[model samples]
Target: MNENNGITLSIQKKKINDDDDDDDLTGCFKRLKKRKNRKVKKKEEEEDEEEESRRDIDNLV
Candidate 1:
């Protein structure tokens, strides 16, 4: 029937919208993860540089 077809189309549209929202959320999470990883990597690099400086000082002394 036409009524049933209309209902089915509405449901399909809603499902598509929901899928888009999920994709947006997934993208946000991915960006946050990348930012966190970059911060961690930068901190590690800074620590390594500090360690090297200490070693140089120790050698000089």
Candidate 2:
């Protein structure tokens, strides 16, 4: 019985360690996704500004 309990405890500890590693991986992915979103938004804003400037020039001409 005692040997069985020790084996069970070790298994539980291994499961906990695996869960922590999964959490870390998800966190890293979240940060990378956020950085990608920021870059996309910046690019869109730049494109809009360029389009507006072109319109202004057309009106002046």
TM-score of each prediction:
0.86, 0.81
Give the clash count for each candidate: 0, 0
How much does each candidate deviate from the true structure in C-alpha RMSD? Answer: 1.2, 1.5
Instruction: Please write out the lDDT profile of model 2 over residues 1-61, one tens digit for every residue.
Output: 9999999999999999999999999999999999999999999999999999999999999
Local accuracy of candidate 1 as per-residue lDDT tens digits, 1-61: 9999999999999999999999999999999999999999999999999999999999999
Instruction: Assess each prediction's global lDDT (C-alpha) against the native.
Output: 1.00, 1.00
Question: Stretches of candidate 2 above 4 Å error?
Answer: none
